[model samples]
Every structure is written in C-alpha cells, then in structure tokens.
Target: MADFDYDLFVIGGGSGGVRAARTAAATGARVALAEESRMGGTCVIRGCVPKKLMVFASDYADLAEDAKAYGWDAEIGTFDWPRFRGKLHAELDRLEKVYRSMLEKSDVEVFDSRARLADAHSVELADGVRKTAKHILIATGGHPFRPDMPCADLGLVSNDLFLMEELPKNVLIIGGGYIACEFACILNGLGVDVTLYHRGGQILRGFDEEARGLVAEMIADSGVSIHTGTNIVEMKLADEVDVETGTISNSDAALGAPAKNDSTSLGENPKSETRQKAGKRIWVKSTTGREGTFDHVIFATGRRPSTADMGLEDVGVELGRSGEIVVDEYSQSTVPSIYAIGDVTSRLELTPVAIREGMAFVETVFKGNRTPVDHELVPSAVFTRPELGTIGLTEEEASERGEIEVYCTSFRPMRQAFIDKPARTLLKLIVDRETRVILGCHIVADEAGEMIQLVGIAVKAGMTKEQFDRTCAVHPTISEEIVTMREPVRAG
Candidate 1:
C-alpha cells in the first residue's frame, strides 16, 4: 500500500467514478479520482440535472393553463432565462461542492484535471504528474456527437445549449432522439418557434410504439413543428444585405448555394460577434428539399463515449467499435488491473445504472466480494413535454419473445378533462402469457417518470399480471389506470 500512491485510481469525476472512489475509500482503500471538468460529470453538469431543471421551467406554461382550468385565474408571463439560468448554475455549483465534500470526508484524493492511462496500473494527469495505483477505474462518461456534414460546425450540440446567453427567437432541432424532442418541447414551451427534423418516421425509436406515439402527438400538439423523414442537407450563414440596417440578403440564395467554409463559422469562435450573427439566421436546406432560415440549428443526433486520446489503446485496453471500453459483467476490462463503468462502457447510459456499476466495482475490488452489475429491467424516463417512463420490454420486444398480452389506456386525464385540454395520458402493461408475469410497464403522461419507478419495483420483483390485478386501485388519479385495467386490450 505504501509503494503505490493509491489503492484505486478512478478517472472521470462522473457518477460512476465518484461512487467508486467514495465507496472504495470507505473500505480503507487509498482512492484517488481525477476529473477534467466538473465533479458531477454529465448528469450533474450538462446532461440530466440541468436538463430536468429546464424541463420544469418549460412546463410552467402548461401548468398556468391547468391552473386557469381549475378556476384559479392564472396566466403565464415570459420565461426569464437569465434569472433561471443563474439559479440553475448556483444549484449545480452547490451540488458539485457536495460531491467534493463527500469525497473529502471519505478521504478520497481528487485531481481537477484530465487523466489518462500511463499503463495498466498507472494514471497520468494533465499536469505532467503520473501516479501509480494497484487498480485503475475509468468512468469518463460521454459527449454529444454531431454528424459530419457540410457546414455542420454551424449547428450546436447539447452541451452548447446550457451556455447560451439567451434562447433564440426560432430554432431548428435536428434528430428524433429524446434529447431533440425534449429540447423542442422546452423551447416551444418557453415561447420559441421550434421545428424538429428527423430522418425517421417517428420520434423515440426504441421505446414502446404506443407510448412513443402518444408522446409524439403530445409534443406536436404543444406547438413544435415536427418534420419526419427529413434531414439537413446543407447549412450556411445568411448573407448580409446591409450591415448598418442588420438586414439579411437573398436568404433563398444562401440556402440554395453549397455551404462555403468561411471565417464566420463556429469553428473560428462561436462567441464572436460574427459567429453570433451567423447563428441568428442560418440558411438551411433539408433532404426533403425545403429551404428556410432559423435563428439557431441544434443537433441532438447522438453522443459518443469520452474515451478518445485517453491512452487506453496505447495501454492495450480493448475498446469496442464505438470506442466504448468493453467490460465483463463484473466491470473488469481485458486488462485485469483496469476496469470501467458508466456511459464510457455504454452498458446503460442512466446515472443510476452508472452508480450501481460503481458500487459493484468497489465491492468486487475493495471488499473481496464478487459483485456483477445487473443491466436488466431498469426503469428510465424521458423528460419530454409529457414524459415517457418505461421499464422492461417494449410491446414489440415482448411479443417476439413469447405469447403476450398488452393492456393500455389513453385518454384525457381528469385535470385536462376539466379544462377540455387536448392533453392525454397513457398507462400500459405488457404481460407474458406463459408465466403470467408483467413483462413491461410503460407510462406516457405528466410525472410518468415517477410512476414508472414504482412500477419498475413490481416488474423487478417478478410480479405477475394477476398480482397487479389484485392490488387496489387509487381512484381519481392517472396511475389508478395502471391497476384498474381488467381486460387485455390486445392478446396474441
């Protein structure tokens, strides 16, 4: 223990790294963690935490309308992005401090710099310092990826959204993923004209078909113009007609011409005045042959694991095609002395899953107990306008496995019904006919995320359809629909 600087060295200060560091330290292991950026990683700094706060901010418009429906004369004023962004940053700073203090209390040494593998058992920090450890854990997480295309640099990724000075007057979001849909709803709710373009026919391709359908309808109804089977072909800066008048010239010509690499591109300096002006009115042509100008273009296409240039390949650590570090059930990489967890592994991108993998790593390495992370039946929620909360198999997946029954209900909820609002909710259950077990539970409505969590417990415990049938229903509530559906709406 004295020979090595740390018993365990964790790279990346995300959820997985933090949990492993703190837990391993608690077991009397000398643990050190290195994070290049913020302590909270993606979930805390850029991904889930800040995104959820934005979701809440956007929902106020609907809430105000609901309030008016309930006879409480209510109105929604303009969203104060500056005030909300300030509070959001403050809260995030406080959270990061809490993580730091937790690690400090646990005696975990933290390095606020980039870290990479020096070898199987050594980590090199950005400060030209190299440290040795008996074991190294990588939990570097992931970063948003923009598809390669002409003038693609002009578009913004998910990370850029958090740093914007103010919301754009109009925005064009590219992609059909949850991130794109979520932001579309968010901007639309905040009074921004949002248009979403996806090459696919529907949004959220992996979720339960019925659930995603409901969510898509809800999002479109919320004022987001969604264009399916569409993608950006080219993007260029709007031509200036008069610099003094701040007028754009020949927007149509700008959209028609092949995008030319110019000094005003975001690759130069996105914060510069030229770049800001270029972003204000981006002329874009789409695969569908539509040409238009938007205040901003956001690409939520996908995210890639943050494993590049981390010396993993140099150290002979095996990585998959997507650059994710391949790991066993025990979170052990091919290199015996090294391991990985979290989004970097691409096992399951949820924060809770990463935290669990971290705990398993600590138990397996520090406590001399073999613990394999479980990756089945995890519940997750997408913070779209009306969130989609789901667990276990989708209806398509369940049907392919075996004979199954699907029970689902979609209707305007009591709250929305009172106001004659078009907003609707869906509660669905998928059951395996052979074992009578509830194979899946999916919800599409307000607080769907919260509802699916409780449902996840039942599914995780191997609860049967009959068991769900036996439980008493909570009346006058949306979730009661989950327990009250007596007959299977569809069976095979």
Candidate 2:
C-alpha cells in the first residue's frame, strides 16, 4: 500500500462529508476533512437547521388566532425581528460548535480551507497545501443558482435568507420551487407583504399537480400574492430606473444594499455593490409586463452542484452538464480513488439522502463491503403551510407506466373545520391495479411531512391496497383517511 497522509480526505464539511469523516474515523481510518467556511456546512449553517427554525418562528403567527378560535383570549403583538434574529444566530453558532466538537471526538484531522483535487490521490487546499490520501470524498453540496441578467445580482439566493439583519417588509420571491414557496409562507407569516412570481404555470413543479395546486390556494389564503408564469426580466436600483417616478424613498436611496453573493463587475456598474444589497428596495419589471418595487427580490430558481473550479475535470473525473460529479451506485467517481456524495453528486439533494450516501461510501471503501446508496422510494416534504409530503411516484408518473388506481380525498380537517379555517387536507394513494401493490402515498395537510415518513415505510415494503385497508384507522386523525378510503376514486 502506498503511504498517504489520510486514509480518506473529505472535501466539504456538509452533512454527508461530516458524517462520512466521523464514521470513517470511528473505524480507525486516518480521515481528514476540509471546510472552506463554517464547520456545519449548508444544512447546519444555512439550509435545513436555520430554515426549519424560521419555519417554527413563522408558525407562531397563527398561534394567537388559533387560540382565540378555541376560545382562549389572546392577541399577537408585533414581532421583534432583531431579538429573534440575534437568538437565531446564537443557536446556529451553537450547532456549528456541536458539529466541530463531534468531528474532534472522532479523531479526524480538520482543515479550515477549501480543498480540491490536485490529482486522483492528492488534494489541494486553498493555501496551496497539498495532502495525499488513499481515497478522496467530495461532499461540497449544491448552491442556489440565479438567472443570468444584468442586475440578477440584486436577488437573494436561499443561503442569504439566513444571514439577513432584518426581514423585508415587502419582498418579491422569484421561482416556483419549494425554497420560494416556503419563504413566501415564512415571510407572509412574519407579517411581510409577500409577492411570489414563477415562470412556470404552477408552484412546486415535479410534485403531484393536485396537491401543489391546493398548496398554492392555501399559500394565497395566507396573504401571499402568487403569480404563476411570471419572471423578473428587468431590475435595477430605484435611482437608476427613475428616482422621481420610482418608489425609492430619499432615506431608502441613501441606504445601500448589503454586499452578498459573488462580486460582480463593479467597473461595469459603479453602484452595483450598493445596488444589490439585501436591504435596498428594487424596481423590477416582470415578464408579464407588470412593474413593481419591493424591499427584496429572491431567486429560488434552482440549485446546481457546487463543483465549480474544483479541478474534478482536470484530474479526469467526469462531471455532468450541471457540474454534478457523475458517481456510480457506490458513489465512486471516474477516478477510482475519488468518490462523491450529497448535492455535489446531484443524485438526491435531501440532507438525509446525503447522509445515507456517506454511510454507503464508508461501507464500500473502508469496511470492504461494497454498498450502493439506495435512491428509490424516498420520502420528501415541502414545509409550506399545509405541508406536502410524498413518497414514490406521482399520480402522473405511475399511470403512464402501467394500470393504476388513484384514491384521493380532500377535506377540511376537524380542527380546522371547527375553527372555521378554510385550510384543507389531501391524502392520496396510487396503487398498481395488477397486483394491488401501493405504488405511492401523498399527503397534503398539517404535519403532512410527518405523515409521509411512516407511509414511506409501507410503500417501500410494497404493501398492497388490501393491506392498507386491513390496517385499523387511527381515530379522529386526518391520516386515518388514507386507510379508510376503500374504493379507488378513479382508475385507468
């Protein structure tokens, strides 16, 4: 065996990278992991952890009203954003510490620099330090992408959402994906006048149409102005557009935009730095020919694997068109010594999926047991109001393959109905007609995310429609509807 510094050198300190480093180290492998920025990567620092906290904070907006509906005397006061933001940052700092501490205990050497492939067996850090390892794992994850426009720099990506000093009063969120919808709900609940525009005809594309359509209705009811098939084609600082005719206030014009994202051509646009700040109000014209000015514009268009300028290709590692590391079932890249997982691979972008891939990598490389990361029948949830939880194929996807039956029900649940809230619940099961096996389960309701998890187990096990019917219904629960719906609402 050739002598190397580390048995495994992990690039990226995100969930998958951290977990792989820790697990490999636990097996007595000399693991070394590098992180360019924070210790906890996206999930802990910018993505899931902080975003879920924001979701929790946003959920409280309805608490006082829901309490009143249940006959409790309560009224919501103004939300103190500064106080909440301070605490949020503190909590995130604490979590990052936890991630670092765990790695320390794992006996893994840590590098606080951006590391990339110098060769199949050698890794290069940002400071030009070169380290050799028997195996290299890339877990750099993905980043939110922006449309290429002159002033597209003005829009905020999902990562920027967590670092805000204060929330915007009126915000325009671009795109129809989960990030956009979730933030629309989050900001709307936080008392921001929220406007959302998507170039697509509906929000939450690639999901079940009926479910996402209902989510759209519920989001609108929450006070978000959603416009589908719309996109921002023109944007600039209000002063640049026409200060006298624009919505730019004298004080607002004086306030510069917060510096975030990549450095654009400061020479091309002198005020570009100040013009694209998070706090600055932007004048925008949408594809629909509507013109408006808003406190902030967010681009939730899509995310690409963060594989840029990493020398993956330079070392003969194959990358897909979207810059994702093309990995095999075992997460091994074209170069045998180099492997990748998580959003960087762009197979499945969920944090849990990334962690699973990391586990599989360790098993394959370290344990002498080649394990393939399973990507089938995975459950996912969108944390919008009346959350959408789904596993397996969508109704649209399943029917095209073979004979199928769809049993779907949408109704206002007891709690919401009692309170006279208009929010409704949707539970759908897509079953194969030939063998009666349940192919998919989808839920759209409060705690829909929670519901799909258990349902995923059943679907993954290939439980049949008869089997679901055989199971006893949980009394007075919305999920029980899934079991009690005996006949197919429609079959083809």
Candidate 3:
C-alpha cells in the first residue's frame, strides 16, 4: 500500500468515476481521478442535460400553437439556434466547474488528461506520467457508433448536434432508437423538414409497443416524415449528384447493388471548405427507392463502449463483443485490482445507474461492505415529442413471464380537447394476474418523464394494484389517471 501513489486511482471522471472518487476520498483515502475531457462527462456535457434543454426548446413551438387556440395572442417565431447554443454551452461550463469544485472540496486529486491502464494496479497518463494505485476503476463511458458503410463518415452523430452553427433546413435521421426519434422531433419543432428512416416496422423498438406506437403517431402528426422499413443505400454530396433526365433507380431494390462512388468522397478532409460545405447538403438514395437532397444526414444508429487502446485487454481484463468491460455485480473486472462501471460496462447506460453503481463500488471496496448494485426496476424516459416514461417490464415482457392484466387507455386530454387539438395522451398499467401487483407502468403524454419517476417508487416498493386504487387521485391532473384506472382492458 505504501508503494502505491494512491489508495484508489479512478479513470474517466464521468458520473460513476467522479462519484466513486469523491466518496472514497471522503473516507480519507488518497484518491485520484483522471479525465481526458470535460469534468462532467457525457451527461452534463453532451448527452442528457443538453438534449433535455433542446427538448424544452422544441416544446415551445407546440405551446405557442396551444396558446393561440386558448384565445391568447401568442406569436411564435423562428428558433434562435446561435443564442440557445451559447447559453447551453455556458450552462455546461458552469456545471463542469461545479463538478471540479466538488472534487476539490473532497480533497481528491484530479488529472485533466487521458489515462490508460499500465498494469493491474497502475495507470499511465498521455504525457508518460505513471502512477500506481492499490486499486483502479474504469468509467470511461461510451461514444456513438457509425456503421461500416460507404459515405458513413459524411453523416453526423449525436455528439455533433451540440456544436452545429445552425440547424439544417431539411434533415434525414437514420435509426429507430430513442436518440434518433428524439432528435427528429426536436428538429421538426425547430421548423426543420425532418425525415426519419428506420429499417424496421416501427420506431423505439424495445419500448412498450403500445406506448411507442402512440409516440410514432404523434411524431408523424407533428410534421415529421417517418419511413419505416427504410434505410440509406447510397449517398453523395448535393453538388456531386448527376441531374440526369432518366428514371430514378428503385432505392429499395438497389440495396444489394454495388454503390456508385459519388463525387464527394467520404475520405475528403473534413477541415477543407468543400467537405464543410458538403455537410450542409447531402443527396441520399434510400432503400425505399426515394432519392432526395437533405441539408444534413444524422446517424443515431447506436453506441459502443469507449474501451479501445486503454490496455485493459493487455492486462487480462475481459471485454465483451462490443468492447464493453466485463464486470461482475460488484463491478470488479477479471483482474482483482481492476473495476469498471457505467456505460463502459454496458449495464443500464443511465447516469443515475452509474452514480448508484459508483456508490456501491465505494461500499464494497472502501467501506468493507460487499453490496451488489441492483439493476432492476429502473425507470427511464424517451424524450420524444410527447415523451414516453416507463418502468419495470414492458407489457410484451410481462405477458411472456405469466398471466397479466393490462389496463390501457388513450384519449384526447382536456387541454387538447378544448382547443380541438388532435393530440392524445396514453396511460397504461400492467399488473400480474396472480399477485395483483403492478408489474409495469407506461405513460405517453406531456411530462410523462416526471410521472414515471413517482411510478418507479411504487413499482419498486412492490405496491399492489389495490394500493394504487386506494390512493386518492389529484383532481385535474394527467397523472391522476394512473391511480384512477379501473378494469383491465385485456387479461391473459
């Protein structure tokens, strides 16, 4: 222990790493944290915080319309991208400072550079500084993944959204996942002509089918062109497209065709003016035989763990197929002294889960308590136009396990009904038939994220359906419907 430079050396400085470092340091252990980028990591810097702000900004468009319907002379104007981006970055900078101050107050040494594992018990910085620790933790998180396809480099990922100078006029979003749908809605609300192409029958593939269906309907109704079972087959810069007077090839049938090398090559230097301008306008041919020119092509396909070149595999730490660190319930890697958590571990890639796992790691290593982090009944939200909040199991999942009763309802809410808005809200409850316990709760409505949070507590507490019925409903609120729901719509 005396030979080690720190009692604990935590790598990556994201939510999980920062929490473990600060908590361990509170116990008077000499803890050190290394982060290559911003202090607050993905959630505060790029992922959740900034994305939610965009969600809020996007909602104002609908709000103004609703205001007009309510007889208020509320005028809606163009979204100021530059102004919003400036304030968003300022807020992120402030948050990073707060994270740094928290570590400083906790007496944890922080290194603002990249760190890689040198051995089971040591790490090396990018500057060749070597430090040994009695224990090491990895929380490097993840980055967006782009498929291996020609012209793939020409598309933007989720990270690029925050740095854009101006929103595009016509955007093509690829992927059926939450990130893709959320951005589609966000851009559409910002007055962009958005086309979402998901190579599936519907969007939000893994969510509750009913809830996701409602979301898809709302997204389409809000002026987004959704093309299910569609994908890009070939792409070129707008300038490179040959405007020939011939029949356009069937894009869907051209899926297996040898793609023609378009004028603007993907390998073109990004910093060059041509490449930069090309990003403004892309010509794409989709699998559905549709050819169109778009201002931008955004790929939200997926994300993989950021575990490459960190020397984890060299030191005998097992990695998953997607480069995720393989860790046990205690977050201990194959190597005894090494541990991993957060998105890097590929376990429930949410900020709260990462923070909790970090606390559990502290309890296991620093406090001499072997506490296993529970990954069950985690509440989550997809911030689409209407938003979807869910917890526990999906109806499809619960029915497969055992007999279940589904209480589902969809209707136009009072506010929208009064204004003759076509918008509708959905509230659903899945109960175990044998136990009469609420197995899952799904909501598709405004502030569904806020509603599902409270629902999480009830579901996690194993509250029965009767308990929910016993609770008094708060009048004139959307969430009150959760408690007031009676009679199962479908039981099996």
lDDT tens readout by residue for model 1, 1-492? 448988999998888899989999998999899988788988988889989999888878777777876889888788888898899889989999999999999999989988889898899889899999999999999877667675566677777777676778989999999899999988898899999999999999999899999999999988899999999887776643342355444554343432222212112235323456554467788998988777778888887888888999999899999899999999999999999999999889999999999999988988989999999999999999799999999999998988999999999988778788898999999999889999999999999999999999999999998898899988889999888998999986
Kindly give the stretch of ten consecutive residues in candidate 3 with the minimal lDDT sum: 260-269
lDDT digits (tens) for residues 278-363 of candidate 3: 54356788998998877778889988888888999999999999889999999999999999989999999999999999999999
- Model 1, clash count? 0
Model 2 lDDT tens row, 312-338: 999999999988899899999999999
Question: What is the lDDT of every predicted structure here?
Answer: 0.86, 0.86, 0.87
- For model 3 the local lDDT of residue 86 reads 95
How well does candidate 1 score on lDDT at residue 132?
97
lDDT score at residue 364, model 2, on the 0-100 scale: 93
What does candidate 2 score on TM? 0.94
Residue 455's lDDT within candidate 3 is 92
Question: lDDT (0-100) at residue 356 of candidate 1?
Answer: 97
